[model samples]
Target: MLLSCGQPLPLLRHTDVPPRVVENFILTGYRFPNYSLRECLLSAFRPTNETGNFWTHFLPFFIFLYYFVEVFGWEGAPHGDAQFFYPLWNYFIGVFCLLMASSMAHLLNSMSLVVREVCFFVDYGTISSYTVGSSLAYYYYIHPRAGTVETGGRNDSHMDLKPEHAGSLTSSYAILDFSVFFETFYIPSACVVAIICVLSCCNTRQRWRRHRYLIRTFVFLLPFLVSSTPIFYRLLTRSPYLSASSSFAASTSMSSFFYRHCLWLLMSAVFNISKFPERLAPGRFDIWGHSHQWFHCCTFLSILDELHMIKTEVRAILLSPTLLLPPAVLSRLPGPTVASTYGVMFLLQTTIISIIVWFSWHANSIHGPERDQLAKDHPKKPLKCH
Candidate 1:
C-alpha cells in the first residue's frame, strides 16, 4: 500500500485491528499487520494513532543527540576527566537509547506479533537503563555529603561539642551517617531495581495482556522511586541548602529545577495510568491528543529539567572548593566509577532482555499459525468512515 504524508493507506478502525495493538477508546487510525518494511518506514509520515507516538520521541531523540554531542565535545571527552564526564555520558546514552527504542517500538511494532512483543521488551529495557543513568548522575554529581550536614557548612570543630556530651554525640553522628551507606550502594541498588523493573514490565506484558495499566505503573514507579532515593532524601532533609551563604542561591536553583522535573514525572505517570481526555471522547481524540503522547512530552520535559539541575549543581561544586567532601566522607564513597557501573548494567539488562525476547518469539511461533488462520478466516468487515 502507498503510505505518504499527503495520501496514506486506508486506516483501520479499532474493530478491524488485532486486539494486541488496539488502544483503549481509540476507535480509528489503526494499522494492519504484515506491512512491508518500506511501508512501515513511511508510516511515520502517515496519519495514524501511532504517528504521534513515533514523531514525539523521534524528534526529541535528535534534540537529545545534539545536546549529547555538544556536551561530549565541549567538556565530556575533551577534558579527559572521566571522573566528572562519565556520569553525564551515561545519562546521555540512556536518554538516547530510551527515545530511539520507544519511537521504533511505536513505528515498526505492526510488522508482526513477535516483533511487537520484542520491541516493547527492548523499550522496557531502555527505560530500565535510563533509570540507572539517572541514578549514576545523581549519585556522583548531586548527592549531599555527610560532612555537609554535620558541619552545617561551617568549619567549626568545637562550636557545639561538650566534654560530657561527646560520647552521645558520636553515637548520634553514627546513627545519622546514612549518606555513607547510600553513597556506597546507591548505583548498585539502582542497577538491581532496573533489572527487576524490566522483568516485572515484560512479565506484565506477557501475563496480563490487557488492563495491566496499574500493574505496569506500579512496577515502573518502583524503579523511579528507588533510583531517586537520594534526591528524595536530600529534598526532605534540605541538607544541601542548610547554609546561609552565597552557595544558597546555587542550591535554590538546583532544588527548583529538581522540583520541576519531579512535577513532570508525576504528570507523566498520571497520563500513563489515567489515559484521560481520549478516554472521555474516544473517536474524537483517536488520531491525536492521546494520553501516551502526553506521557512522552511530559517525560521529555522531565529529562530536560533533570539535565539542568545536574548542570547547575556541577557548576556550584566546581566553583565552591568547600563543597567537595572531606577525606572522611570521600573514603566511604563507592569504588566503582559511573562508566564501570554502566558497563555492568548494559551487559546484565541486555542478557535479560534477550532471554525475554527469545521466550516471546518462541511462544508466538507456536501460536502464530493459528492466529494467522483465524485472521484469514474471519476477515474484518468494511468499516464506515466517520
Candidate 2:
C-alpha cells in the first residue's frame, strides 16, 4: 500500500485567526479567539492570500453599488427619461454582477486546478453578460419616443421641447426612430463577440485550428462592415432622425481608429499567441500585477474611454436645438430637469471612480505570502511593470 504524508499546515495563531472565524464569533456562531479586539478588527480587514483577491474586486463593486443606488433610487429626481432609466439600471446591475463574479473567481481560483477552471469559466460568462448588457442599454435608449397625454385640452409630449416651439400651431412630432441600428448594435456586438471568441479560443484545443481563422477574420472585418450599417441605412432610408454623428457612430469610429492604428490588432495577436511577457513570465504574475490583470484593466479602460466619448457626444445631442421638439409637448413628461439628473450622475461617477482608484491603490500596497511565493517561483524573470 502506498503511504501518503500530508505536508504540515500552518497553525492559526490567536492574532492571525481567519476573518471568517472572527465574523462567525461576532455572529455568535463560534467562540472568539483569544486575541485583542483591536487586533481582531485589524486582522479582519487585513489582506490574506485568499481574501485579498476577493476584496480587490469586491471593493470596486461596492463603490459602484453605492453610486448606482444613489443615482437610480430617487423617484422624483430630474436627470433622465424613463426609457433611459431602465436601461441604465440594467447596465449597472450587469456591472455589479460582473464585479461579484470577478471577486468570486479571484477568491476561489487558486484553491485547485479544477476550481481554477470553474472560476475562469464563471468569470468569462460574467464578462460576456456585462458586455451584452451594456451594449443593450446603449441600444435601447439612444433615442426614445414618448407617448402623448391629454391634459386640459393640451397635447403633452413625453420630452421637453425647445422654447422656440412655445407658439407653434402644430403638435410637436416625436418619431420612433431606428436610424443608427448598425452603429448601435452591430458594431458593439462585433467587438464584444470578437473579444469573447478570441478569449475562448485560447482554451479550446479541438476548435482552435478552425475557429482561430474565423475569429481573426471576423475581428478584422466586422467592425468596419458593421459600422457602415448606419451610414448605409441613412442613405437608403433618407431618415432625418439619424444624426450624421451619433454616439454609436462615434464609438464605431473609435473602434475603427484603434483597429487601424493597430492597438487592438496587436493586443489580439498577443492574446492569441500567449507570447512575450505573458509566456515568459507565466506563474510569475499569478499574483499581483499579472499580464492578465493588466489586460483586463486595459480592456476596461479602453471601453470606458470610448463610452465616455460617446456619452459626451450624446450630451451634446441632448443639448442641440434640432433634437428638441416643441413644448406643449414637454409639459406631460414626468421627470427631473436634465441638468439636475446629469449633475447627480456626475457626482455619482466621481465618487465611484475615486473609490475604485483608492481600492486599487490599497490592493496594490498589500504584499501577501502568495506574492512572495510567486517571486520564489520566478526569481530570474524581470520585474513586471505595473
Candidate 3:
C-alpha cells in the first residue's frame, strides 16, 4: 500500500531549520496536526518520514522473531552445549528488543516530545542489552586456550585441559577472565545509559538539545572501546596454533567476529552522522535515501554478521573436544528450548511499548505547557510548506 511521498507530518520544531524528509513525520500528519495511535500505526502501511526508520527496524524484528521461535525456541541444546545455543537465543532477544525500541521511538517520536523522551529511554536500554548480549558470545567462543588444538594433538584432550593448554593458550574461563570481561563493558555501558537518562530529562533544555545526536553517537560508540580492548589484547598475546592449519584459523576467528561487529557499527555511525545523500539534497532525499535508514540497515546486518561468527566458534569448541574446558558458567546458559526465555522477552517489550504509548497520549493532553514553553524558548519560523 503506497501513500503519496513527501506527505507532511506536523513536525514540532524548536528551531527555524528546514525539515528533512523523515525523523518524526507520519503519513497522517498531512491530515491532522496530531494523529491517533491507529493513524500512527496505520501509517506504517503507507509511506511517511518515519517509514524508513520504522521498517528498517520493523523487518528485522520479524526475522529475529522467527529465529527465536523456529531455531532457538524449538532446538535442543543439550549437555555441554548450553552455552552456545542458549546464549544465541538471548542474543536474539537483545537484537529484537533493540529493533522494537528503535522502531517505536521513530514511530511515536513525532507524536509528542514526552513520548519521544520515553522512547529514547527504551532505546538507550536496548543498546546496553545488545552490547551485553554480543559480548557474552565472546565469553563462549574466545577462550584463552583457543589455540591449544593447534599447539598439541587431539590426544591432548586426555590431560587436564586448562593446564595442558596454559603455555600456548591463556587458560580462559577463570573468574578473573569473567570479571575483567564484563566489568570493563558493564561499567562504561551503564554510565552511557545513565547519561542517556539524564539527557532525556533535559529534553526540553536547549543547551543539550544542540548536541543531543552527537552526544548519543559518542555514548553509542563508547562501549566499543571496552569490547575491543580485550579482543586485541588476546589476539596479540595468545599464541597461534600453526601446526594444524584449521586450528590456527579457529584461534583467530574470534578476532574476525569482533572485526565484523565493529565494521558494521562503524558504518552505522557514519550513516547516522553524514546524513549523506539526504544532507546534500534537501527534499529530494526525503522519501528515501537518508542516513537514518542506512544506519538502521547497517545495524541490522551487523547483528546477523556477528551471529554467524559466534555460531562458527561455538561449533569449533564443541566439535573439537580438545578445546573444551572444565565446567564453568563463563559461557554457560539455560536450555535453549525453554520456551520461557522467548515468552519473557516478548512480553517485556510488549508491555513497555504499550505503556509508552499510553503515557505519551496522556502526556500529549497535559504536556501543552511543557511543549509550548520549550517551543517559546526555542522558537522556529513557520514552515514554508504551511
Candidate 4:
C-alpha cells in the first residue's frame, strides 16, 4: 500500500529481487532495486525489512550529534584550551560518522547492486575508522600509564582548582605501567590493525559471500578486541571496589562503564552472528524483532556507555590535570597530534574502500543483470546475515 511520489511502490517477495539483497530467513518486504533517490530516502518510512535497520542508527545519529554540540558548547570552550579535548572530539565524530553511514547504507543500498556494494564498503570503512578513533581516545585517556595522575597536593575538591595550576600536581601512582616498548607502539599498532580490519573485511565480503558471516565477524572483532586491550588489562589487574586515590577512583568508575560497554558489545556480536529468534521462525520477523535490529540496539547502547565513560575521564583530567596527569603527557595536550593522527587513519581507510568500491561498480556495470541472474540461479548457500 506504500507509495513513492504518488505511485504505489509495493514490497516484494524473496523471488522478486536479486539474491544479494535477500537475507536468510526473511522472505518478504524487500524493496525493488533501481529506486529513485527520492524513493530510497522515503523507504525509511515504509514497512520494509530495512526500515528498522535504518532507524535504529539514524535516530541515534541525531542524539549523538546533539550531545556533541552540547559537549562542545558546555565543556570545551568554557573550561580550558580546546586542543586538550581533541580525543573526546575524535570519539564523538567517530560515533557520528558510523551511525550515519550505517543508517544511510541500510536505507539506500537497495538502489542498485553497485550502490549496495559501495554502501556496505563505506560502512565497513567507517567502522574501521571508529576503531582507530577509540584507540586514539584510549591511548590518551584510558591506558593504564595515563590512568591515574598523581597530583602532589590533596585539594579534596576539584571545583576549587585552577586550570593554570594543572601542571603542578606531580604524583605518579598508576595501576601498572607497561614496558617502554609497549607505550611507544600502542597507538601505531592500533592504526595498523584498523587498516587490516578494513582490508580483511572487504576481501571476505567480496570473495566469500556465501559463508562470510563468521569470517566477517572475526575480521571486525579483532580490531575491537585489539583496541580494547587497555581496558581489559585494567579490569583484570585492578579492583574497582577499592579506591586508591581521587584519580584512581575516577579511573575505576570509568572501568565499570567499560565493563558495561563490553557486555553490550558481546550481546551485539552474538545477535549479529547467531541470527536468533528470527532464524527460529522464518518470515515471521521480516519486518521486526530480527537479530540485526537487536545488534543495532546493543551497539548503540555500547556507544552510549562509551561516551559516558569518556566524559567521566575528561572531567577528571580537566578538574585536576597536574594531580591526575604526568607532565610529559599533560604538556602534549595542547597539540593537534592525536586528532591529526585520527584524521590520517580515517582518510587512509576511506581511500582504500573507495578504490575497492570503484572497481566493484565498474565490474558490476560491465556484467550487468546477466551476472545477477547467474548469481540467483546458482545462489550461494548459507546466507547468514541481513
Best candidate (score: lDDT): 1
Model 2, which residues run further than 4 Å from truth?
1-81, 110-115, 141-278, 281-286, 317-386
- Give the alpha carbon lDDT tens digit for every residue of 1-386 in model 3: 11234343443332332132124321222222234465567677665556788889988878756544443333232353353455565666677778898898777754445655566666766776666555444544454332222333443332344555544343432213444434334434533443444344334222465566666676656556654444554565543343344444554566676678779988888876666666676555555666778889988877776766666565545544545443233233222343433443344445445544554565566555666665566543333432
Better of 1 and 2 by lDDT: 1
Writing each residue's lDDT as its tens digit, candidate 4 over 1-386 gives: 22423554568999888777799888899987766587788888788999999999999877766655655454323343355666666777677779999999999987667777778777877887788778877766665344445334443343445565443432222445553424666667777777777777666656777767777677877788778876766565542212334555655578778888989988988988899878899999999889999999999988888877776665555444442333343233323464365575666666666756765775477446754665566442333332
For candidate 2, what's the RMSD? 15.6
lDDT string for model 1 (322-349, tens) is 4443223323454346446568667766
- Each model's lDDT comes to 0.70, 0.39, 0.54, 0.68
After aligning candidate 3 to the native by TM-score, how far in Å is the CA of 345 from where it should be?
11
Number of the top TM-score candidate: 1
* Residue ranges of candidate 1 with Cα displaced over 4 Å: 3-8, 66-81, 144-175, 238-248, 321-331, 334-339, 370-386
Clash total of candidate 1: 0
Query: Which tens-of-lDDT digit does each residue in 8-37 have in candidate 2?
Result: 122233234333222111111121222223
RMSD of 4: 7.0
Estimate the TM-score for candidate 3: 0.65
Worst ten in a row by lDDT for model 1: 146-155
Question: Given candidate 4, what's the lDDT at residue 52?
Answer: 97
RMSD after Cα superposition, model 3: 7.8
Candidate 3 structure lDDT = 0.54
